[model samples]
Target: MYGAFWRILPGPWWIRLLIVLVIVAIVLYSLVTWVFPWVQELTNATDVTVGG
Candidate 1:
């Protein structure tokens, strides 16, 4: 699967690397900005105590 993606990207190696990095950054930012907070709300993850 990864090899197919790498083959499909339309660029030289460095350009492909840059594009992949940008894609990863966008995904990470989206997850952190929206997805994580939504899941946290659903799970109530902040109100936790380890060992009182």
Candidate 2:
């Protein structure tokens, strides 16, 4: 899968590396800004002792 992605990207090694980094940053930012919050809401987790 990753091999296919690298093959599809149009650039030299350094440019491809930069593009991969940008893609990773965008994915991480989206998870942090949206996905994680939605998951947390679904789970409804809270801090509390399970037993005495």
Superposition error at 4 for model 2 (Å): 0.8
Residue 40 alpha-carbon offset, candidate 2, angstroms = 0.5
**Per-model TM against the reference:** 0.85, 0.89
lDDT of 2 at 14: 94
RMSD per model, one decimal: 1.8, 1.5
Tell me which residue pairs clash in candidate 1.
Answer: none
lDDT of 2 by residue, 5-45 (tens): 99999989999999999999999999999999999989857
Give the per-residue lDDT digits (tens) of candidate 1, residues 18-37: 99999999999999999998
Runs with alpha carbons beyond 4 Å of true place in candidate 2: 47-49
The C-alpha lDDT values of all candidates are 0.94, 0.94
**Model 2: which ten-residue window has the lowest total lDDT?**
43-52
